[model samples]
Target: MELTLDDLGVTLSRRRVLDGISVILRPGRVTAILGPNGAGKSTLLRTAAALIAPATGTVRLGDRNVATLDPRERARRIGYLPQNAGVHWNIATSEVVALGRLPHRAPFAAPGQHDLDAVTRAMAATETAHLADRPVNELSGGERARVLLARVLAGEPDWLLADEPLAGLDPRHQFDILDRLQEVARQGRGVAIVLHDLLHAGRVADDVLLLKEGRVLTSGEAAAVMTPDNLRAAFGVEVSVQRNTGGGLVCTPIGRALATA
Candidate 1:
C-alpha cells in the first residue's frame, strides 16, 4: 500500500500553499521533504495525513481516497506528528503516549492489553521508557520531542508523516531519531518527514523531494535529487558535494549565488 498525492493543489486563507504536488509515499522506505522556510513542507505532511483537504486532485491511501475513509480507519492507518507537537496537560509521559490509543479504544473502555503493549514498545523505541512516569512538562525540549514522537509511534500506524522531527535535538539524538525512523521504514511502513538538514536527508532518505516556494524543484533518489546544481537552483547557494568517511554524501554551501530569490 502507498500514500499517493495526485497533483495536489492546496490553498490556505485564499493563498495557495502547495500547487501541483504529486508524490507517492511507498512502504518500506523514508521520503524526506526538504525545503527552505515557508516552502509548505509542513503543509504537504498535513495533506498526506488527511488533516487538510486539497483544493484540487486527491490523496489516496492505496486504491481508496483518503477522504472516503472512516476517521478512525484513517487514524489507525496514518500517524501524523507535527513539528513542536505539544502537551497541554501536566500528565505522565506514558499517559501522553496512551492517548494515541484513543482511536483503538471503544467508547468509555479502558486501554486493553494491545494498547498497553503498543505504548510500551513505542516508549522503548523512542528511548523514552525511563521517562514513563515523569510529567511531560518536566522534560527538556528534546526529551519532550521524543515523547511526542513515541505518542505517534504508539498508534503503530502503517504510515508516518512527521514534520521537522529532528528539530530541537542534539547531534547524537538527531542521529538516534533518524536511525529509529529508518528502522521504522525498514519494518515495511512508509515514512514521510519534513527536514532541513540536507546531510541527514542524504544519509537517511531513500528518496527525496525538494520543494521551493511550495513547488517541487527536484525529486528522485536522494543522491540524484540533491545535486549541486539543484541546490543552487533551489537555495541560490553554490555548494560542494563530497563523500564523507562513511562514504555518505555531504553537502557544503561555500558561497551565495547572485540568483534572484
Candidate 2:
C-alpha cells in the first residue's frame, strides 16, 4: 500500500509539531526519516500510522483517508512500533507476538493454529524464536526490542512505521533488524523508519526525509538528501561525504576546525 501525507500539519498543546509536511511512501521501498531530536520525526510516524489525529491536513493510504478507516481495519493495514515501546503484560514472548493478530481475530476469540503459525514465523524472521518461551519482562533490552519488532511483523500489515527501531541494539542486531525490514519492503509493503544513524540510513533506505525544527528540510532519494550542506545545516557539524572504494558513500565528520576555517 502507498501512503501519502498531503500538506500534513500537526499541533500539540497549541505548539506546531509538524507543518505542511508532504511525502509519498511507495510500496516495496524503505524510506528513512532522519533529523535532530525534537524535529517531529516521531510525530510524523504517529500521524502516518493514525495513532494521533493530525490537527490539519490528511494522511491517505491508497486514496482512502486514514482517519476514516475503522481502528481495527487500520491496525490490520498499518503496523507501528513506537520508540521504546514497552510490553505491559507479563505474557510469554510468543503470546506477546501473537497479539499482533488481534485485528484479524474475532472479538473475545482465542488465537487459533493460524495465529500461532504467524507468531512462529515472525519470531523466526526476527531470530527471536529461542526467546519465545521467556517472559517478556525478563528479556534484555535488545531481546525485548526484537520481540516487539516480531510483534509488529506478525500483523502482516501493508505499511510499517518504526520509530528508532534500531535503538538499544548492538551492531549485529541493528543490521539484522534492518535486513528483515528490507525483506518486508521487498514483498511490496511500504516502510517508514526513523533513524538516528545517518550512515545506516544511507546504506539501507531508498528514500530519505530530513527534518529540522519540526519542518522538512528535504525529501527524496538518500544520496540526494544526505549532502554535506544539508547535514551541516541540520546537525551543525561539518561532514565529508566520500564514495567508498567498493561503492556507496561514507560520511565522515570534519569537526569544528573546518567550520572555523
Candidate 3:
C-alpha cells in the first residue's frame, strides 16, 4: 500500500497547523518526519491516519481517497500510535494488545485463533511477551511505550504511522523498536514515523522529510535531504556531515559559529 498527500493543509479554529504539505510514502521503506517542536509533525501523522480531517487537500491511500473509506475499514488499513497515549483501564498488557484486533472483529464476536496468534506474535516481537499478564498502569514509561507499540503492530495494518514512539525508551529499547520497524518495512509495509532524534532518523530512515512552520523544508532520500546546508537552514546550527567508518552519514552539530566573512 502507498499513501500520497496532495497539497494537504490543516487548520484548527483560526490557526493553520499544516500548509500545502505534499509527500508520498511507499511500501518497503521507512520515512521519517523530522522537525523542531510544535512543527506540525504530529498533525501530519494524525491527518494521514484519518484521525483528523484536513481543512484542504486530499489524502489518497493507493487509488481511493482516505476520506471515502469507512472508519472501520480505514482502521484496518492504517495503524496509528499517538504521541502521548494513555491507558485508563487496569487491563493486562495482553488484553490491551488484543484491542488492535477490534477493527477486524465482527460486532459482539470474540477473537478467534488467528487474532490470538497475532497478539502473541506482536508481544514476542516487542519483547513484551513476558510482561503480558502485567497491569498496564503498573509498567514503567518505557515498558508502556513498547506495549503500546506492540498493540499497534498487532493490527497488521498496511500503513503504520507512529508519533515519537521512542520518546520514553532507553537507548537499547530505542534500537529495538527501530529494528522492528525496519523489519516491518522489509516485509513491504509503508511506515512513517515522527522522529525527534536526527541521528536515529539517519540510521533507519530510507527517506527523510523535514518540516518547519507547517511547511516542508526539504524531503527526499536521507542522504540528499540531510545535507549540512539544509540542517543549518532548518536548525540554525553549524553541523558537520560525514560518512561513518561503518557506513552511513553522521551529522555532528559542532555548535553555533559566526558566519565567515
List TM-score per model, in order. Answer: 0.95, 0.95, 0.96
Scored by lDDT, the top model is: 3
Q: What TM-score, to 2 decimals, does candidate 1 have? A: 0.95
- 175-197: candidate 2 lDDT, tens digit per residue: 89999999999999989999988
Tens digits of per-residue lDDT for model 1, 1-261? 888989999999999999998887788989999888888999998988888999998999999999889999899999999987889999999999999889888978999999999999999988999999999999999999999999999998899899999999999989999998999999999999998877788778888899999898888787888889898888878878887787667877788987565
lDDT of 2: 0.90
Task: Summing lDDT over every window of 10 consecutive residues in candidate 3, give the lowest-scoring window.
Answer: 244-253
After superposition of all CA atoms, the RMSD between model 1 and the true structure is 1.7
lDDT by residue for model 3 (110-194), tens: 9999999999999998999999999999999999999999999999999999999999999999999999999999999989999
Ranking by lDDT: 3, 2, 1
* TM-score of candidate 2 on Cα atoms, chains taken together: 0.95
Error of 2 at 229 (Å): 1.5
Clashing pairs in 1: none
TM-score of 3: 0.96
